[model samples]
Target: MGCCTGRCTLIFLCTLQLLTSLERQIFDFLGYQWAPILGNFLHIIIIILGLFGTIQYRSKYIVVYSIWTALWVAWNVFIICFYLEVGGLSKDTDYMTFNISMHRSWWREHGPGCVRREVPPPTTRGLEDHAYISVTGCMVEFQYLEVMHSSLQILLALVGFVYACYVISVFTEEEDSFDFIGGLDSYTYHHSPQKTSHVQLKPVYLSK
Candidate 1:
């Protein structure tokens, strides 16, 4: 059979279906609203291609062919961008930093940047030159949820890489088989024409 054809092709199809369904379930469990939008769209695409391969295209070669094509495309997307984790602001805050000890009026009156801007370190006199105040850091805005969501994409990308390797190995095996046959054909066709008829009928007599 051709690359990833027959049983291999069927295995790949089943795996894809299972993976897609599992992803949907996981997304739903996480209460991922965008899951339906993104996951469902990709799921539909895979179903259409798989359906075409299994029903319209009788050749398992074509089924695997479509899968390889899809895999490579997904691999590219994954390699290029999917794995990278990025951060973004979740919401805007009134001040860059907040100090619980300080009153809101004090912040508004002094101007908001860092709280230290309003309450600078005392350089002069009895405030204690050696006393250290534990200062809380800035109230930076970030989407913790987005960071978590991106982890799943990174995982899927890794899986896609493995799938690409599997498909590539299957394709290479078929290519090697074809190359071997082609080499045999090339050697015999040119060098053994006088014996070609004998060789052609040799198999029949051998089977007897």
Candidate 2:
């Protein structure tokens, strides 16, 4: 039971990490006006379910968790491929400029009073540059973290898959053992011959 508790904790943490990473990516995509919100929302729900299932130790939940993990793994692989295709981090060298442009465009289109009020330009060049630099650094760090999290998620999912399989095998073995014991007892009770007591003829004659 202690072992199971520990394993559940690990799984929960891994899932939480995956959730955080996904949320971060989703937020970034949303900022850029290109996020798949519904898919990400579904992923979040699946992770939550997995966490609940792990804590409760339910096989059905574990199965769901495993399936989601598998799908997440595939999604991560696809993302990695896409990232590479886009020339990886090197292509993001102009992240600050791109992000600023995206932010401006998004705010212009969606911000409150967009039609009534004009967007304000940066007041201080030095401060603006500094802020963009900081933002760019954070973006770089986030990108690296995203890759690391994806890799870690893959490992976690693999471990979870194996654990799920083990749990299933254990249940199967227990059922088989019970069935065998039950069948053996049933056969012994029904097939074995009954013993009978022999009567003494001498005793009967004396009585007469």
Relative to the true structure, how large is the alpha-carbon lDDT of every model? 0.44, 0.55
Write one digit per residue (lDDT tens) for candidate 1, span 56-96: 43345444544544554453343223223214321222121
Question: In model 2, how large is the Cα lDDT of residue 82?
Answer: 43
Output the worst ten-in-a-row residue range by lDDT, candidate 1: 100-109
Write the residue-wise lDDT of candidate 2 on 1-208 in tens digits: 7446555654766566566657654554654523323445666777677667666655577677678778878876654544444545442333423444533112223333333334334665654443321121122334344455457757766776676666645545666798999999998887654322233223553554
In Å, residue 189's CA in model 1 sits off its true spot by: 2.5
How well does each candidate superpose onto the true structure, as a TM-score? 0.32, 0.50
**Residue 193 in model 1: lDDT:** 78
Q: List candidate 1 stretches off by more than 4 Å.
A: 1-142, 196-208
> Distance from true position, residue 165, model 1, in Å?
1.1
